[model samples]
Target: MPLSAWRLRLLIVSLLTVSFLGALDHTVVATSLATITGELGAVEQMSWVIVSYTLASTVLLPVLGKLADLVGARLVFLSSLALFVVASLFCGLAQDITQLAIARVAQGVGSAGLHLMPQTIVGEVTSPRERPKVMSWIGAAFPIAILVGPIAGGLITDAWGWRWIFWINIPVGMIALALAVIAVPHIAGRSGRRFDIVGALVLGVTVTAFVFAASWASAGTPGTGIPLLIAAVVAIVGLAAFIAIELRVSEPVVPLRHFANRTILVCIVLSTVIGVGLFSVVSYVPTYIQMAYGVSATVSGLVPIATVFGMLVSTLVTGSLASRSGHYRAFPIFGTAAAAIGLFLMALLPPGMPLWVPMLAMGLVGIGTGAYMNIIVAVAQSAAPRTDTGSVTATISLVRQVGSTTATAIVGGLIGVGVTAGLPASLDASTLTPQAVAASSAAVQAQVAELYSSVLAPIFIGLALAYAVGIVAALLLPHGRLSDELEPQPVVGAENAAETATA
Candidate 1:
């Protein structure tokens, strides 16, 4: 029987809740990092707290997605939520950074499942025609979480404590768990396919090495270049091995044939490009605002809310339009172009422009990004064979995460080099905080602003270039209406028999 309307709505709400909680974890913890490190007395190892979760989550994404395909999404989703709740409890209770980091690893495992399974379930439940609308709701969770998390984190951390950041998840997790248990149906996979353990290992190693290299590069601590280089080599070798193994495996964790599909490949590329642009802006723009305008951290943090608001509006509008028209290629094409224009406009902003200028530019970028947020995933799932849905979805997630990490590393390098070049010999780059900028003489402030603008211009230009690449990819996307029917799995026996008959 088809799912009832009310049931479908309930299921979506449940999934969105899971998605929000998973997405919120990173931003909230990031905002509370200082407090966390201070209370735990592990300020020197602060990066590990965030890095550990990111590495674990990135490594486990495909593994958990494969597990969902093997066992069942309902089982996986519920179990992950339970694990997240338990991990959150431990995180809140931790007396030291080591324990907190360990707990975060567990949380990352849950987060991986939470992030991957909900979208997979959305694909399972909705017809391609309706998927855009449903997926828009799901996709909106991340930006909403991004918008709310920092402010909430600051408030909660200030009023209560950093532990409350983790503690807050417990209630949300419980609610999502209850709703999921009631609303989500069990989605069973083929029983005969063997798990590809070797492929999983290789892929994990490749992702870990790549992520470690990017993290080190972004950290830019002196003497880390050699380690980064070594990681890059390992990542290259591991990725080659992974591809080789996947090609030979009967049932691979990631189906090699998906890459052979031009449409799928293009969608993946677009996803990565969008990820780079979106996350780069989200991660660094606030810092840019603080430095350029000498605003309080709170005010600068609030500036990104305009972007998130724009995203929310565009997501709903474009998603509905795409679903109604049963076409999606236009969304990405137009969206990417809009994003590129916005980014270019941002790059061109002169120092001491009106405050609304950057915020408006960010809003434009958000609108462009939002238009394709869930549409690309819907398109990829629609294009792939039913048997490969989980794998395709996981691959999209993996590529996007890698893109975000890569963008962060690239932007960090650009800023680091630019600051080093622009700052005078007498000025220590470490002392160039917003507070310091505010305290400096008028001449000093003007000089710093000019230097900052010069550095930021290139970063924004780079962002525009990424979106421009996305625009090309989007233009190249195959024009096909979303099929009303669910994707069909291939029949191995029938294919073999047909081949024999032809011979």
Candidate 2:
């Protein structure tokens, strides 16, 4: 069916609303992790909750996206949203860390659909000329969710308990599901293509292994030794097999032909670096705030507000500039420089400094993050042919997730090292407590704060290094813009008929 412009817009918005919930929940539970750990008696497994979700999401992103293209995005999206709601309920009701971790994996699987399907929907309805503007607007929702999510979660967790973090998704998901069913246009996939089952399994195991290794090592435990080694070896083998398989398959999950485009390859690498810096810094900032200032969970949650504000403003400005001038080189260049500078400044926060200083520094980080948000995707898409748009978008998403996961592992390890190294040798590891140590009159609280501060600085500096890598990658990326005819178009025969009948 030939869809009217208004109807298409309605459909896209409805889909994005659902998409926003998926994206929002990704970080909502982060700040409340401590509370969850205490209640569940599993503080050590805290990072796994975060890692499992990201690992699940990262592994499935490209696979699910390819499946959407093979089957139908409509079915995948609705089913994923439904699963997200159900999984969230399970997460809220979980009696153990294992249950919570499993629930998170399910949520992550659902998130893959949420992250992918909407972009497909957007592409189907909007024209190439309008895509940048429309994409810029659609992108706004994700950041907006990020900006408010922590505050919302903090309030909910503080008032109702951490369980509400999962419970909150129920209403939001229901609304999104209702809207998606009503307005979303049905788009079918290319038939006769086999879903690369082996490839998917390899990718899943590799991601899970790598994530597990990172989380284990970060826990400052000796048990992680064998697992980390095994994970690394398996990931290397899995990746090699995937590359070999993709090159031979007629309908490969990852289109190797696209890699031939030097520009797209460079952009993917740069995005990976950016993801490392962005997620590591954003994910751990609250921990720093909590330790450095001894702030309450609710108050510490506000620390990210500065970063969110900066992102909001910079994104709007840069997006408009790109749309109007059609020149995109400066975004990443300025973004990387600003990010590096911001991270360096953050590292320099003197011991016991007031909260405002670090908050201001986060604002700078946000500026850099916002500046490059869509520029990477835009460059990748423009470098590819029209038919490759979905894969191209999915590629960047996958790359970013890998980078973020790697960074989380690296930074978490660094933080652990700093904390461990700074502790007095006379202190007992198993029964250590900030207050109890302080009572012993051994300069306990001061020493603990000092160790945390020392550790935090190096993590921030590594994040700066990641941004520097992104700058180099951005410089290497080829220059281009979207074509005039890039807007949404109907698939020639049956799919269009299905859409029309629905209309």
Candidate 3:
């Protein structure tokens, strides 16, 4: 009755594939923002589309990761996938930015399930030794999806329309859903414990408030300050309550025991740093190109390809190295160090330099960022007991999300508005008026690019500092291969046929 080897492998692939749908949706919207803004009159509200989706995913990752441990992953995985597809439909059909933003919130909730659950599902189905190789596929899928997103968006938006961006997810989501139901392993919920309602509420509010403050810190100078202060107060109060509730609750939402491991402590610190760099790079690159070089949206989307290519290139090389040497620490150490250097180098570029120069700079950062994931995540999970693997995986992810969101907010604030007060002499617009600015927005957009390029260095430097911390942590990680004894025990089957299948 145990699943055939083929079915198990198929299940892993299916989960990663569905997860990729959610990941792809994140980046695909970046290049098409201009079109969405123009059509929906959402210039000011445009940032929310990215922030909301990311914030939702960040907040839910820890909760859902723990949920996967409590209730079986099979149920949670399918439900999340179904929600993502439905939300995509709503997003595509939205008439206004407000409607689209609301739909995006739904999409974000669905995406959290897709993002966190797949890793847990993979852990459930594959042995610890086999997990690295399978996880490589998952890690690789992330950059590939991100890289392809813009190209696909450009082609679709240019040929058909922006709606196609969301529309394309329909077929992919359904296919992943069908495969998951057919192929994924069935897991049952753990018994004898109730959901920690007080803890869940407190943590949820804490994450929500903090994420909003961090995500929207760049909205305006005056606007961001008070809200950020309020959010800080809410986060502190909520976190205090969460800790108190967890201490008293018979069953906590996140078991504090999981944080006791030294390795996990190191991994969490490193993940936060990596998160800051990775998210900062992804969020700013497209805007950098558009604002600095006066490129069209379609053209701007292509800039990320350099980073994507660098990531792909490094992944293949380092993966082979890890496999050959059977040592993982060296890769992350090198990767993070290189990434810090790359980010610093990017800071040196003058505003509005040639396209190829900036592209190469981003590529360097990509190479470094791409190399860190497999090494760190694998190391972190290996450090925890088997029963806590899902928890550890989710924890790293949660830290990264918080780091990235925090980075975006900080960078957004530093970069100020992506607009310049002066236009270049080469750009002749003698009749520049507010009315004309509205009609011929492209000209105004050009000035913004010049300003953005000039200020990109400081953002990269801040990112560089984060990656530097990650490198230091990677160096301190204990060096050894993962052992099965360190893993969680496998579940016993419920019936004769189920037992046979599990066997």
Candidate 4:
């Protein structure tokens, strides 16, 4: 077989490694975010640190998938890896928040491919049935990397420096790239496919506008509210125009029609719902702990490893079970139900509860998350045609990002509202660091902590509701056995694959 030399295990490791790098960078700075912003003298701009990378990555995900479908996944992967490594170097060297954010944007562009290519590549070499097993290993990397980031960031910042976090990507990315080049099979792109340049451009602007509008609105920085409104209007208009353009174009950046499929529609809805809640929990809980506990970033980061641990257990168990049984629908339904319970418990916690309480609650959510995302993705991919793999995967990722971005905004807004109404003047909610809060008067510290916990409680409650909705969505997923064998490739495409890899 053409894929014999590719070594399935090695290919899985290589893809996981690449995806892990992207996932790591997207979140590595989170635990150290306050520290990074404090040092750069732009604490007010802190959310931008995460938002910039997320925004850039969110917009590019589907576009890169389309490009890979047109050119080659290997070519896109290699180029993206090279770009990510270089951008990381600049991110580390950045002297100011602006410079750091700009570097992060470049890094995000590369991150999009790193996050997307593994899903795309798995489609290349493995049967649909095999992917649950392989993706269980590969897909777990992104979530694990995301969860481990705070711990990694805290530990690194405690010992080395925050800058080193970005710098570390260079060596790891290089190794992943080298391994992929040596081990991964080349899958040829569709012949004579016309790239949808115009549609792609419109999509980029639309996504950017929506993300920024959400960011600005969430921050609630006085003068920025109007800009957010303007951005929102632009985003709405862009969405309408982008849809119109995509429909008119011979080859749309996103094939909107595929969205009509019940499986695709349900999977996307699930992605959006799960993505909103899960990404919010992953992004904010550590920050919440750091602020409320007045603990160092290291300790704050450590607690969330339980989330990583829980996710680890679920992904391995569910993935292995689904692969052998060829049944995946139950996982998402069970997972979302479990996650909703955990989140509800999170919302119900009393003030001044022990640290371990949150650790447990968040861990439960992780368990649920681990089961749902991978299974949902596999089901969606299985339902789509073979030729539609990359776009479909990209669409899933893009929609998930959109959900994440929306959740981020909603969470941030909730916190902002709390700060405005209840926070004392003595406490600067915008620039809170664990170290700074520790030095403040005990009364001020307690007030700040209480306010934060109060605000976060509702956010969790809201997320619990979202996951509850996901349960119904998951139930709607199609239940049929995925194919046990790989779909046969066209003879011409198969022959050109090796040639394309070399070229």
Error of 2 at 388 (Å): 2.9
What TM-score, to 2 decimals, does candidate 1 have? 0.94
Candidate achieving the largest lDDT: 1
What's the true lDDT of residue 408 in model 1? 80
**Cα shift from native, residue 199, model 1 (Å):** 1.3
**TM-scores of all candidate predictions against the true structure:** 0.94, 0.85, 0.83, 0.88
**Model 4 CA deviation exceeding 4 Å by range:** 31-49, 92-100, 151-163, 287-303, 424-450, 488-503
Give the TM-score ranking, best first.
1, 4, 2, 3
Between the candidate structures 1 and 2, which one is better when assessed by TM-score?
1
Which of the numbered candidates is closest to the native, going by highest TM-score?
1
Estimate the overall C-alpha local distance difference test score of candidate 4: 0.80
Poorly placed runs, candidate 2 (over 4 Å) = 1-5, 31-48, 92-100, 154-164, 217-220, 290-302, 424-450, 487-503
lDDT of 4 by residue, 402-423 (tens): 8888778778777878866888
State in Å the error of residue 494, model 3: 35
Q: Candidate 1: worst 10 consecutive residues by lDDT?
A: 494-503
List candidate 3 stretches off by more than 4 Å. 1-5, 37-44, 95-98, 157-164, 215-220, 286-303, 316-326, 350-357, 417-454, 484-503
lDDT tens digits, residue span 1-503, model 2? 44687886787688668867887897688768899989999987787898778778888888877776777677778988999999999999999999999999999999888887777656545443344455666667677888777777888899999999999899989999998898877776776877778877877787777667666667657666787788778878888988988878776677776566666676687678767887766767776776666665556656677887787788777777776666666788898889888998888886668888888888888889888786566655655544555666788888888777777777867776776667777676456554445455436656766777888887788788888887887776555544444432222232232122111
RMSD of each: 3.8, 5.9, 6.5, 5.6
lDDT values for all models: 0.83, 0.74, 0.72, 0.80
Colliding residue pairs in candidate 1: none
